[model samples]
Target: MHARTTTITADPNRIDAGIADVRDNVMPAVSGIDGYVGLSMLCDRSSGRCIVTTAWQNEQAMAATREAVLRMREHATEEFGAETPEVREWEIAAMHRLHPAGDDSCARVTWSRVDPATIDEVLDVFRTDLIPRMDEMPGFCSLSLMLDRQTGDNSLTAVYADRPSMDASRQRAMYIRDEFRRGLHMSAIDVAEFDLVLHHLRVPELV
Candidate 1:
């Protein structure tokens, strides 16, 4: 799968207004996407930055939806203001589902590379060695990889159970940081904390 993420800075007090605008105005096209799996908008009121994540089946499909995405951004900025948002694209390498609420849990992930490299061996190490270790962490809920089509910066997101799970098991995820370099890849440029909500379409109506 693939995803597009945007980080935009806006006035803290007006965030709720911004979020409401997106829900009312920007979500219509989301329901129309071909490979669109899900979309999430995350915010940190103190940090003044909000993140928007859209997941798709492939890079090409994500590319095809660019016009729609750009339109959403323009609509968002009109309400949130005219600041340029930091943009990043991603490819979803893997995904694991979370149990529905009132049953077990609710957290999920989407990841991509932070370093830009097209070498075959680099990807091999990521898929073979690096990603598996993420799955082994305690309370690890799910995994997904994203690669930007333009810059090639990969972002890896691992979702977990709750505050306790993320706090306790994060280091285990960090252990593989050195391995990326051992594969002659660049070190992580930056990593961000993300809160995710995952949805799957091809499922049975167990209720």
Candidate 2:
């Protein structure tokens, strides 16, 4: 699967309105496009940072809808009163969920860079070491790892059942993250906490 993400840092007070516009306006328009699969959103109310991601079935489908998608993105930026949004695209490397996320679910996203030659090794460690450690944490719900293999940029999101669980996992999550970084020689780019504002994505089953 392919995905496009638009990150916006906007006025904290306007986030609710922006999210409503996405749900009521942008989502319907996106759903009408050919090959459209799903849409999700993550937001940090305190910082007014939001990331909206739309998924497609293939490269061709995503490429074919670029113009329409751009318009939708522009609309979202306008609604949020945000500056030009930072846009990115990635391959959906792996996705798994122990259960569907509920309204109270929250997530932590870690962005990092690794050597392209060692991507597989990094992912192997993630699945074997990182994920298991995460699973033991209270309120763990799901995780998805996205990659831009050519650029060695990767993003991982760990979903938790509720706010307290998400908060409580911080220390151990940080330790595992450090371990992953040292083992892979990866550099951390950004890390953020967000409410799982929307979780409509239905990725194919993990192999």
Candidate 3:
């Protein structure tokens, strides 16, 4: 998978409108891109910083979308003003779409600092039961499960449509966690919840 991340800072006054444009206009363009697997736009309204993330089936697909992505970026800069929004990109080795939601969203950033030797049990439970159950969650439209390609630590950030939905899914997730705790596991699984803020350099639009 080819993963790309673009971080930008939006204008404080135009933050809301910019997010709208991104949702409506920019994101749709990305949705239509070649090898487009999925993407997430994470924003911080108060700080006016935005993270535009995309996942492709491969780099070739990502290459094909460059012009389209750039066009959208240019338009965003034009609409929102380029001075304040600083845009940057990063390439990820493995990308997973934890979840895809509408406008509002939430994320569960689960990371663990565990002994690599004891990972077999955690992974077994995740694959056999937890993953499937969580995938059926309401507002759980898309997901990406990434095992540290090198470290062997199970790191995942599950995405949701909104904070409320994410919050709603927790009991079920906790139930699974409790099961894991009983399966002779050691320390390592840690989860953090984040409230998604929509920000657009121009405006956040709906697709």
lDDT of each: 0.60, 0.88, 0.59
Q: Candidate 3 residues 1-207, lDDT tens each?
A: 555656566676786676677778877777766677665666555666565666667568777776767768877755554453444232342233343455577766555544556566655665666667777888774444444333555545567888778888888877765565567354456665654554221211110
Q: How far is 192's C-alpha from truth in model 2 (Å)?
A: 0.6
The alpha-carbon lDDT assigned to residue 142 of candidate 3 equals 45
lDDT of 1 by residue, 39-109 (tens): 76665566566777777777798899888788788778767653888887765544443332211322323
Expressed as tens digits, the lDDT of each residue in 1-207 for candidate 2 is 888888999899889989999999999898988889999899999999999999989888988888877777888898898999999988888777877888999999999999999988977887777777777888999888898999999999899999999999999899988988998999999999999998887776452
* TM-score, structure 1 vs. true: 0.73
The CA-based lDDT of model 3 is what?
0.59
Give the least accurate 10-residue stretch of model 1, judged by summed lDDT. Answer: 198-207
Q: Report how far off residue 110 is in candidate 3 (Å).
A: 6.3
lDDT of candidate 2 at residue 15, scale 0 to 100 = 94
Model 2 C-alpha RMSD vs. true structure (Å) is 1.1
Which of 1 and 2 is the better model by TM-score?
A: 2
Which residue pairs in model 2 clash with each other?
Answer: none
Best by lDDT, which number?
2
Best model number under TM-score: 2
TM-score for each model: 0.73, 0.96, 0.52
